[model samples]
Target: GGVALVIDGKALGHVLEQGMHHAIVRLGSVCSSVVCCRSTPVQKQQVVKTMKEALPIRTLAIGDGANDVAMIQEAHVGFGVMGNEGMQAVMSSDFVIGQFRFLKRALLLHGRWNYLRTGL
Candidate 1:
């Protein structure tokens, strides 16, 4: 029930040129998922921004360094890799966690709680 469109930078740019029109259409015909990969964090952020503009879904961008800043800011929610990197990503993130395992609670439980708290 998924489509793994593992594209690189060039192909990602092509797909995004249309404001993720292609990905959206492909997603519509899928069983329920699509995993798109890009080369750099900046490119990743661009893709997420385009997808957000074209769709109503929320995006979660994660990274460990300054390189990840753009994507982190681009997402509806961002998770910075803490401990491994300094305070950079953690400071920029909506919520901070030290381990990947903690992301489940941060993303699932805290995300909903924040949304409700914000009245969004």
Candidate 2:
């Protein structure tokens, strides 16, 4: 169990490369804390790119708006929340899902299958 941290955008510098990577790395060191409440679309993508670079993370970005498109594309697995905000997120996503509830089984089954296939 972990807490989610809504990283304050004010804490980030105008040049977010270094700052964003540090933030995501710190967040990843903890167990279940998610980055949230971000106000910028760029921030969403920044977190994913940072984590992907600093860790062996296979990220799943879920979104429902045009703002989420870049973030979804930045992730290893992009799940779109269909009909929530717009179709843009879904159009750019790897998969479109109707409900958030299904993510658990999707991840579980996908993880299991990948493990068997790759032995990772």
Candidate 3:
């Protein structure tokens, strides 16, 4: 499935709504869901809850700002992107990435390697 990108704000709602419609038409029956603009942490949590109710599955949240802390906490795995110093997201996440390129290695290579070693 394709991913949906949303900006955090009420104004982005219209954009997300349009994107959702376009995604529905473009992906047709393969599109399982559509989520519109979310303006608050409460809304983000509600969305996650709704998705879980619809289909119980693990979810991962990756973010790089203080605004993302709530959603990150709601996800099964939360990754904080530390592109620069003093980013609050790094403090709140389960894992922190110092560089953008290292994110792939952290998730795929390091995480998997550790999992294999521990069998957890």
Candidate 4:
């Protein structure tokens, strides 16, 4: 069983500031994924930082805009989608993809192969 929690920027602001473990535990028990919407660049970075520090798992951030540069850089692995947004995100990302649909193959295939090879 799994759930996806949709949190807006404002609702997550407080959690981003402090006590992320509590929020992670409470949320993790019920949800397998989280979708944060209407977040600022700072908020996006903080979320990535908070999760990276709080969990023992690698973090991945994906974006296609300049506003996503900070978040992309902050994550353990960042994927930038090439689009009209510009090259800021592409430069900051660990990897760049021409289209969003390719994310599945990139992650499920190449990403998995890399993970196994690296033993991470």
lDDT of 3 by residue, 2-110 (tens): 6554445574455345545343234322334334344666556545544544455666666677777787787778888986545777888899887767878997999
Between candidates 1 and 2, the one scoring higher on TM-score is 2
Regarding TM-score, does 3 or 4 come out ahead?
Answer: 4
TM per prediction: 0.68, 0.76, 0.61, 0.82
Candidates in order: C-alpha RMSD to true structure: 3.8, 3.1, 5.6, 2.6
The alpha-carbon lDDT assigned to residue 65 of candidate 1 equals: 71
Question: Candidate 1 regions off by >4 Å?
Answer: 1-7, 13-21, 28-38, 112-120
Candidate 4 TM-score versus the reference: 0.82
Which lDDT tens digits does candidate 4 get at residues 30-112?
A: 66666678888998887777777767877788999999999999999999999999999998999999999999999899978
lDDT of 1: 0.70
After TM-score superposition, the amount by which residue 101's alpha carbon in candidate 1 deviates from its true location, in angstroms, is 1.6
Residue pairs of candidate 2 with colliding backbone atoms? none
Score residue 28 of candidate 1 by CA lDDT: 36
Residue pairs whose backbone atoms clash in candidate 1: none
Q: Tens digits of per-residue lDDT for model 2 on 34-112?
A: 5545447887888778778888868888888899999999999899988758799989999877887877777799768
Give the higher-lDDT candidate: 1 or 4: 4
Comparing 1 and 4 on TM-score, the stronger one:
4
Candidate 4 whole-model C-alpha lDDT, 0 to 1: 0.83
Model 1 lDDT tens row, 1-120:
454445677777676675766564455344243444545766777766766776677777777777778888888988887776577777788777787788889868987898899996
